[model samples]
Each structure stands twice: as structure tokens, then as C-alpha cells.
Target: MYEGLMQKVMSDSKSKAGQYFTPRALIDSIIRLIQPQPGEIVQDPAAGTAGFLIAADRYIKDATDDLFTLSEDQGNFQRRQAFRGTNGCPTPTAFA
Candidate 1:
């Protein structure tokens, strides 16, 4: 719902939203298809807002019962190591 609203705002704006942002629905669909697993590294080299990485993390956590199925070490790895994105933003930060 929030992404939908963000999409609307981006589309309605005259800024470079189209260039910087992708529709969340598409991101969710791609993440669903990719089905990133634990231990597998997922990266977005040109990440704008890190949407793809965020969606992939959510998808994996949902599939893995919030990583309860993983060992503590594996879960830590998933939270910190599995998703990586490179961006030019001066204040890059994880969404979670």
C-alpha cells in the first residue's frame, strides 16, 4: 500500500522519479520469481532506493518463516550478508 502511494507520487511528480524509481509491483514480481535463498548473495549494482534488495530480503524472510528455520549464525548472515547494494547516495542506509 505504501509503495503504491509512493508510485503514485513519483508518477505525478515532474522530477526524475521515473529514472530513479521502479514500480514496487514489478519489484515484488521479480523477487517472487527469483526466490533468493539463504547464503546466496543478491546485489543491485545501480540501486536507487534499494527496492530490489529490500523486496528480496522480505521475500526470503517470508519464505523462511522470518529466518526461524535458519541457525542463529545463518540468520545473522542473512540479515547482514545476503543482500548488498551499491549506490551513490552519500547517506546510504539499510531500510530495516
Candidate 2:
């Protein structure tokens, strides 16, 4: 999923400008420094190809052992609520 988005971004000339792909080491370092906790909302306004989101998601899941296991609809609801009330962005929905 993320690869496809990256491909599309790379293909778009306008979007590609100033859009160097984030290296894995940099992402890993950021994740380690941030140390996102489970159920703690995160967002990146310039989430090019969702690299940060994907990394943060993986970090949170690994940290929490996948505790936030709500159904898709319920997850969406919680996500919306978090964003509306706290301006916190929810994790991406997991597709079945």
C-alpha cells in the first residue's frame, strides 16, 4: 500500500519536487526518539507516502502488542472522536 503511494508521488513531477524519500535509518531514528505509545494519536501534515505514519504505526503496535484491537467501524469512530476532540490524528484503519 505505501509502496504504491510512494510510486505515485515519485511519478508526479509537481509533487516530486523537494520530496526526497526519507531514508530508513532516519525514520528509525525518529521513531526511536519519539517513542510513540499505543493509542497516542500522531500525524504528519507533510506525510509524503505516509512513511512517518507507517513507521509510527509499526512502532506503536510493537510497543503495545496490538492492544487496540477494535473492529473497523469502532476504530473509525474512535479515530474521528480523537481528531474532533483533541485534534489528534488516529492511526490508519487496518483493512481486512
Candidate 3:
């Protein structure tokens, strides 16, 4: 996904090349500061291949292994009751 974005950004002559990518070190630092949690929502207006979102997802999963251990039925019920009234959590399509 990031490779595709990078290719597009690099190919675009009108876009500011400097803004096309976020340094990995900086991304790691930001993830540490935000400390994402399970069942929490996160968004980035300028996601740029969703580095922040991905980092946050990994951080949350790593940080709260216990919290994420919901039984299958409990997890399904929680997902159905929350958000858009879906029957399942759908395995979290995005990082947040």
C-alpha cells in the first residue's frame, strides 16, 4: 500500500515532494506518545499511506493483549451493539 502511495507521490510533479513521506523514526515516536487502545477510534486527515494508523494499531495490540482477548461470542455481541449496528467487529479493517 505504501509502495503504491510513494510511487504516486513521487510521480506527481505538482505535489510537494518533501511532504510525501513521514520518517519512520518520527512515526515511531508519535505512536509511543499517542498510546492507542483497543475499541478506541483513531483518524488521520492526511494519512499518507496510513503510517500513523498502522503504528497505532500495532501499538494497541501489543500494549493491551489482555484487553483484546474477548471470547468470540462476547466480541461479536460488542461489535453488534456498538458503532453501525453490525453483527460482527469485522476484524478491524483499519489500524485504529
Candidate 4:
């Protein structure tokens, strides 16, 4: 849901939002370079809408082949605890 919304917003405002948003491919490439481990925390201090953090989450899930296995506590931890993004802007809905 959120990914679709973000994609739409990004497409609509590409000229303006390009600096604020990171492309999924680039984010994935960065995550692969960093190689976030299980249980490691990933953070983006200048996160616009947590594109990096979301990409890291996807990387971990894809690594484990458990993106849909939320019934497991490990999966829950990966989804909820593994990554965080803090924007300088006041409480963006993405962080909420």
C-alpha cells in the first residue's frame, strides 16, 4: 500500500522529489553493498520516506526467503525492529 502510494507521488513529482526520494534499484544496490545482517539495525537519518530502510528490510526478507512468514517472531523482528528512519522534518506520516 505505502510503496504504491510513494511510487505514485514520486512519479507525479519527479522533478521536485528526485532529490528527496531514492530509486529502488539504487537503494537495493546500496543495501547489497552494505550487506545488513540479521538483527542488525539500519537507520537513515535524512530519510525522506524511509526508502533506504524499506529497501534494507526487503533485502533481509529476500535473503531469508521469509518475507511473507510473519507468523515467526524473527520475521516480526525483521519487519519492525531491524530498521528505522528519522527525518528532520516534523513527524512525517512515513515515520508515524
Top lDDT model: 1
Which stretches of candidate 4 lie above 4 Å from their native place?
A: 1-19, 67-73, 91-93
Whole-model lDDT, candidate 2?
0.55
* Residue-wise C-alpha lDDT for candidate 2, range 1-96, written one tens digit per residue: 664555555555524354445666788799899987544667666564556767776776565455366566545543453221121223221210
Off by over 4 Å in 3: 1-18, 66-96
lDDT of each: 0.75, 0.55, 0.54, 0.70
Best by TM-score: 1
TM-score for candidate 2: 0.55
TM-score of each: 0.72, 0.55, 0.56, 0.64
Cand. 1 TM to true fold = 0.72
Clashing pairs in 2: none
Residue ranges of candidate 2 with Cα displaced over 4 Å = 1-16, 68-96
Better candidate by TM-score, 3 or 4: 4
List the candidate 1 regions with Cα displacement exceeding 4 Å.
Answer: 1-18, 89-96
Write one digit per residue (lDDT tens) for candidate 4, span 9-36. 5665645534355667788899899998
1-96 per-residue lDDT for model 1 (tens digits): 655554555564525433446778889999888888888999997676678988998888898999999999999999888888886543323332
Candidate 3 or 1, higher TM-score: 1
lDDT of 2 at 25: 72
lDDT (C-alpha) at residue 96 in model 2: 8
User: TM-score rank, highest first?
Assistant: 1, 4, 3, 2
Positional deviation of residue 10's Cα in model 2 after best superposition, in angstroms: 3.2
